[model samples]
Target: MGLRRKLLVSIGLILAILLVLLYLATSVILMSSFSNLEEQLVLQDVNRALRVLETEVLELNRLLRDWAAWDETYAFIETGHPSYVAQNLDDAVFANLRLNLMIFVRYPDQILYSKAFDPQGNRPAEIPRGLYAYLTPESALFNLPHPDSSVAGILPLPEGPLLVAAQPVLTSRYQGPVHGALIFGRFLSAAELARLSQMIHLNIDVRAYDDPSLPSDFQEVRSSLTREKPLVVQTPGANSVAGYALIADLLGRPALITRVVATRDIYYAGQAAQNYIFLSLLAIGLVFGEATLILMDRLVISRLSNLSTSVTRIRTSGDLTERMAESGKDE
Candidate 1:
């Protein structure tokens, strides 16, 4: 090709190569940054869920301890009159607790009586016959996967694994060696789970098991923990993900495996990142485009023009050795 055409092609090639390199480099940097952002978002949600759970668990424990200390409990254990114990467990406490907290009395054979906080007051019920086989004659408190002689065990009901926080009831009024155990029961209800979800901005679920081979109840409490509040279902939605952590309550209930959900329909944050990448590319293109022009003008065009003038002068003087006077420059 001609000299001019060759020069034009060389410059175009150089520009094309520079642009492609920039796109590759920027894409790597942007992708890494996006991954880091996702990790940070997930970490934030997990921390939030943990905080709320800690607070709720603490409060529940406090309430249970308070109930155990009530005078009516002393009266019931002393007199064997459950009626007085039921009377003391009122709506005020249940409403304050936001749910019906039950206390069951376990006998040698089965749960002798289970008392719940009803709307009117305390309601008593007998333990299920199916679960009677799990009771014990022991005087000490025991956890689930109950011994054969174990008395009534506190269980999270409507079916989630039980949180059987049992304490042997002992008072000056009781005759036997620690008259049956006092069992505290609290279910992992939707509201309690929702509170956990809100704290983390993510959906929450829990499963408990002693043997990994056993099946479990996977109850979904909320939608997602992402800032966007995405949907959580059998299958995750677009822009959705899930994470989990295993925890065991203080009562030594079965290991509680907690699932934290993160999801959203729209890639609001990802789209924003992409837009930023595009803008950055545009700015870089402009800068390089301008730089290419300026360099061509100064190094190629201007310098060549000066070289031509020097050649013309030398030709006119007929002196082949006449060196060009260096312009206001060192070279």
Candidate 2:
């Protein structure tokens, strides 16, 4: 009803509105920023997974190059040297080198020698039935545009898929009237995938290009070769997210899909921080509002109240000569 009460109400309303707006703005901005940062962290994990897998491939290439460009391998391919096979292509050698398959092909598709091994079983293994049939003249391996250049890629096998590397057989010096091609392969087995997962502390999933069960994000990644960035998605029914990247074989065909997933620890941490900030701000607003109201009541509202009381008394008593007393130097 009076000036002091009206001023108190108006200031309280303004402070309350400002506090609400500040809280909403801070929450929205912080939540959005934290969401983006979590997405970036998922992306970084995916990139690290890709790098580790690529390093494995490069190592395979190096090993294949060494074996392919060896003098014994060249001599064995040319002359069927028994000693070379006896000394070098044994189970111990395969186990030590960690190779799943080794094939020696004499130029235009004549298989000089082909063998598959299971290092885990410590015994000989069979190549995927009919896989060699695809190595005919029309195949990518036999039809290499540059016969001298080396090739490495994924090959679909009955067991699953294999990472393969091939090189033209030459003397150890890498000189050649290329005699033939030598191939080395390693299967992408469960053990291998587990090893990779442990290394990066993320789950890894691999799918065939045409797998009907492939996730939508993975399919999107496979639809284009130029898509350098992975498709990231939050996992359903889990506190985690995944990023999908398409892997192409040496022939530039989408051969495999890889997904990297990480837990939402960072997201959870950000959320906790945001909640703490909101609560702290609310508490601060309450304290500030109380302090401000008290100061206003003492410094401004109390003085105004005294002036109103004196004016009212003069009005009621009909004393036109009466003067209101000054409260302090503030007047």
The digit string of per-residue lDDT tens for model 2 on 197-280 reads 998787887777777777776666566534464355555435877777767766776677778877777778878988888788
Top TM-score model: 2
- Model 2 Cα displacement at 304 (Å)? 2.7
lDDT of each: 0.53, 0.78
Q: Point out the worst 10-residue segment of candidate 1 by lDDT.
A: 144-153
Model 2 misplaced stretches (Cα beyond 4 Å): 1-9, 143-147, 215-238
- The collision pairs in model 2 are none
Clashes of each: 12, 0
Quote each prediction's TM-score.
Answer: 0.62, 0.87
Candidate 2 accuracy as lDDT? 0.78
Per-residue CA lDDT of model 1 for 221-308, tens digit only, reads 2222222432222224456655545454443343455666666422456556666876777677767766776777676766677898
- Tell me how many residue pairs clash in candidate 2: 0
